[model samples]
Target: TNIKKKMKPIKQTCFDKAILRHRSVIETVFDELKNLCQIEHTRHRSSANFVVNLLGGLVAYCLMPSKPKIPVAGTYL
Candidate 1:
């Protein structure tokens, strides 16, 4: 099958687990944003309301002191 053929090689290596581990942080951030900011709900009755809600949630997230962060190492690339 196509799926088996495509996944066969990837499953043979550890790279897939590494990639998933890297993405887990991003996934957790999105999960937090959705739950804490209530952005996942589509209850807006109007286009303007939807846009405002979306922007407001994002701005609030950015202004929060507990926002998720990735630590930086030595120097900038």
Candidate 2:
């Protein structure tokens, strides 16, 4: 939502609820990646180490039993 005026009878802009919901889900996933998976770190001694750490974190996330995901409407043949 956007407010166009600060005075009386303020005008407000409309926003899509679906887009906002999707954005919130994306943020939640990133938060989990950075915090729970420890994907964001500054202790890498070399580029290779950083890459390895990133890959490891991704794999760990994939292996987790429960994770946030977007639902698809239909199956594709």
TM-score of each: 0.60, 0.63
Off by over 4 Å in 1: 1-21, 72-77
How far residue 57's Cα lies from its native spot in candidate 1, in Å, is 0.5
TM-score of candidate 1 relative to the true fold: 0.60
Give the per-residue lDDT of model 1 (tens digit) for 17-40. Answer: 554555766677888779887787
| Tens digits of lDDT, candidate 2, 1-77 | 33347746653334455555468777988998999889996988899999999999999889989887766465322
Best by lDDT: 2
| Candidate 2 local Cα displacement, residue 17, angstroms | 9.8
lDDT of 1 at 34: 91
Error of 1 at 72 (Å): 4.3
Could you tell me the TM-score of candidate 2?
0.63
